[model samples]
Target: MTGAAERMRDRQMTDGMALNPAGPDLAEAMPPGVLREIEPRHLEEPRGRYHGHAGLLAAPHNVEEVAAVVRACAAARIGIVPLGGGTGLVGGQIMQDGPLPLLLSLERMHAVRDVYPQENVMIAEAGVTLQSARDAAKDSDRLFPLSLASQGSAQIGGVLSTNAGGVNALRYGTARALCLGIEAVLPDGSIMHDLKRLRKDNTGYDLRDLLIGAEGSLGIITAASLRLVPPPAANGVALIVVPDPAAALDLLSLAGRQLGDCVTAFELISGQGPRFQMEKMPDLRQPFDSAPDWMVLIEIGLPRGLEPDTALEALFEAAAEAGLALDGLIAQSGQQAADFWRLREEIPEANRLIGAISSHDISLPLSEVPGFIEDAGAMLADMGNMRINCFGHLGDGNLHYNVFPAKGRDRAEYDDIRKRIQASVHEMVVARGGSFSAEHGVGRLKVADLERWGDPARLQAMRAIKAALDPLGIMNPGAVLA
Candidate 1:
């Protein structure tokens, strides 16, 4: 009897054959050399979870294998959809309505190339898991701080491509800031080796910055050199309930002003978000007995020889005295801190289980967060009985504006309002001098919206760069620039 992988592969081929009855299937159309390079079973078989536009195509092991596939697709004028952990919420990894693209997966190219603790750099292959890299750094007594909800599955390539922002961004910065250099395979199969680990090299154009947030539209990243830091001696975590988003902002200001660089994390949570966790996670309990409209998760790290408790206590006292903090829950131990963070990190999963909702990941000037919250929340509440979960990197003013349907409403009915909700929220974002797309890159999901609202000159320049680098348009087509 065939194993599960074989069965999945066979099922995919059967589906592909059924979908393309008149033409040759994906496996049948593969070039001769490329076909031999890929295992026959892997081509017509599914190796992992397949979703979005481009489904299961082929899995590549190294840079050469990936380049070979891209070269073959380029010669044949076929689109190439690059897949990693497939954890993108904006449909970034999905294939779209266009040329039946060849899916180039980097799942097999995982390797830790080099670790330089002295130089503060770690070179990892594209397929290396975020947690794996972090662990490697930890083993060396260093710190690799790029993190997210799906770090277990999301690869370095996808994270860099999307420029992911996580909890620690308030201290260390986003993925773009953490990445020093990259080794990528261009659309036409040429290798662009700019993986230099140095801090300053102002030679010419910053190619690394371009590829970091390109969303696979320009090239496929194979390896990367990331910046690492020294681990903190101790951590201080607090779960504070605030009266509103405004108070959270004031508390954030206090943390920034008083603690300076020690303020490592400043995240916001809504009552609905935590309530969902309490209902779904079962073991999760509200840290405070009474629920507030908004909550703040603050984390600070102490230097060697310094105590965290004293500093944290003093900060909390200041916040309470200033009337910015209502009530708070300080984690008594590291495990308790982990438990508190798990609740914040699992919000997306909780929302996913609930069903389709209009989600917006937008950013604004940090000071404007409170106004945006009031206006957007009031406007959305007036629409109907929809449930809104407004929370995220409050220190950065990036809110994940998610709206759920009224109780007992069918998913299909709620999904129909997605476009309307997006337009309204995006308009609010633009009105407040904010960005429509923040950490999450403009994948196929937001192409039309980007086209409509994106600055004309910037769009033209991006198109020109795309045409300059990928004239054949073989790189992950129908993404970002589209």
Candidate 2:
């Protein structure tokens, strides 16, 4: 389709559907407190990537209220953009160039509806923060294993919508596997009340899975029945120095064999990340006196009988004997473990402060990760003198490979080659049997990448599904499918 035609179609989908927050249409349709003017926080995404345009903001308190607002929007054929915690990195919460959409924020629906401790399940509303869900699980002596750096602000609805994968994904899996069922409002204003806390349900066409990672293009999730698990009685963390990515991978294999499933997290970090952290966020203490060229942060959670510290020590000894690790430090206390994690979690903030010219969240097969890293570095080195910070949940083969300016240089000077850098990295990733987009969903930022890298048949099927479910294209227009 031509660019003009696509723009016209997008605008026409919501033609004559202008929403005025003070107008009678929404004022009369929604309850008094549910409708309000768009606030500054609602207009901005976490990364400062995209500025959203919204004519109205709705904070529905219940599923019925959410359905009512959706019903009104469907009748008017106005687009709906769902907002949650406003912490997404890929601009999923922001609608930049579409007709002013109705921003649906589920902040008022923050509640832990029911907790079935016996079944290890909890039903939580969409607005419940990830940290809040974790706390609720702790109250029942269980664990909500979907942990993220933005857990304090990111809502459960947005987490599931993006199928977020975090550090614990190596052990418990992503958000999709943690969810039992979801309650959502379809594009046509119909509520899909399938929030059952069952282990298995073979009903036709698993709509629950469909909406989980749809990024609100298909529907707005109101609540979910989340799977919970037993909390490990003991946990340990260690930071180990490795010669390079290849050695790090070897260390991972040895540790996995020694610790088995108890290995919860295996993160790969570059010297640049620690240097940036020291420069930008000095409050968080660095584990090493000076940043090693490469390091891996390993975490393991174990039952009471299998002491975590002992297990971690055994793994470290084996890794060192195998020439995989040069040096290591095992956490002796809970505070020490938290300190190690702080260093890993704060790297993104440091990256933000340094200002990346281009950031790539890509994944490769476990065996191919080492070669890809080496080849990608060579590729970027040939392009420019840009510094690279490669780090992420190495256990799952996902890396947050980010590019920045050299020391004492500004990113604005490299703006002309940002797209080239991104394209080069993504191309290398694809050529090496890797995904261009991994845990982070393809929000507005990577839609073009999706089109370029996605399979032709898969893209066609996705477009067909979007058309069938939201014929009017009133749900997150100009997102994911272009």
Candidate 3:
């Protein structure tokens, strides 16, 4: 079907509530092993904030099988919600109120297709866990630098689909930068086999880039050719206590001046995070006897000849001399380094236990971060009595700005202003030239935010592209766009 006729048919389909795979036809058309019953895990999101609806489940073993499933759904006029690792925070994998859709799970397609150590490339299936992809790269003596706390469960497809940014993004960039190419099943049931290992392919249009961060709205990504780097000869991690947020920025600048790209990851951590951990997780080991107002977790990787310990120690000394650092603890062993990272990684879990009134994943220009933190804290103070935990990828300008109710009070007490708090914070972030959704994609959670703050021209172009690509409106309906 061509343009006008296709759009008209789409309109007709939308005039009434869309139907999911109902009678025997959808099941008969699907491959033998593709169909399965929906599970409780599939319907519930991580945060329990969104409960999705799916009439059927389909797990494709290969790209062709994926295309077949897409064809079946298209023929049946069924919306498709592609489920990744389910580690997404923004409710992108969820479809709550739309027509009963087909849940497309890529878990069965897990495979490390190819690895070229000489060329620093690894072809990985979308269903492969991020840790598995990293292991494959390690087996080939190359480093796939995309690192996230949820690596054990987060799949490559969702990571790329969300264009995820993690601790190492300051050095390695996002999932999009680590990827060279992708193979996806377009909305019309045809496969885009563009997973090339080339570094420079001047194709007319970059469909790979479009699909990477589209949150599966564009298509279902089947696999990717990922970029890899040579492993560093030495690595070290340190927790440097800064008196305040501005000092943390100064410390970052000093590290750049002294160590340059050797700094692999730099995370800002608020004392509130450790306080939460101590209150909720008593068994958690802490690096300091008392948590300072703010600290930065810095990891450095260096080539041969330079000792990581000496480099970190020298950097700390310089920072202390410059009045940017108060106290520090450098990891003496691999286990100690893991413990340091464990503390940072478990902050989110601690927050979950305490229960936040509202949480924001935001980013500001490096210069504005400290001021924003101060201003936003004061603004929240005016809005209500609460505690604020501000932490995240300090090197990359992203912060996990979260709000918690006052001590001994339940989060439900602030339910009246929950949405107001979120909006107020996002407004401040937007006014400061910062993004309210930093690494998290605009899933169902932030549809209104995108509409309110999104540039008109960009929204128009996005809608036009969505209409052009998936006129049937089956690919991840109501995600990234309303």
lDDT of 3 by residue, 110-184 (tens): 999999999999999999999999999998888999999999999999999999999999999999999999999
**Reference-based lDDT, each prediction:** 0.78, 0.88, 0.90
Better of 1 and 2 by lDDT: 2
Residue 41's C-alpha lDDT in candidate 1?
A: 28
lDDT of 3: 0.90
lDDT of 1 by residue, 167-248 (tens): 7888899999999999999988888888999999999999999999999989999999999999889888988888888889
Worst 10 residues of 2 by lDDT: 15-24
TM-scores of all models? 0.89, 0.96, 0.96
Local accuracy of candidate 2 as per-residue lDDT tens digits, 190-262: 9999999888789789999999989999999999999999999988899999999999999888877888898
Q: How close is candidate 3 to the true structure, as a TM-score?
A: 0.96
The TM-score of predicted model 1 comes to 0.89
Q: Number of clashes in model 1?
A: 5
Clashing pairs in model 2, backbone N/Cα/C closer than 3 A: none
Candidate 3 Cα RMSD (Å): 3.6
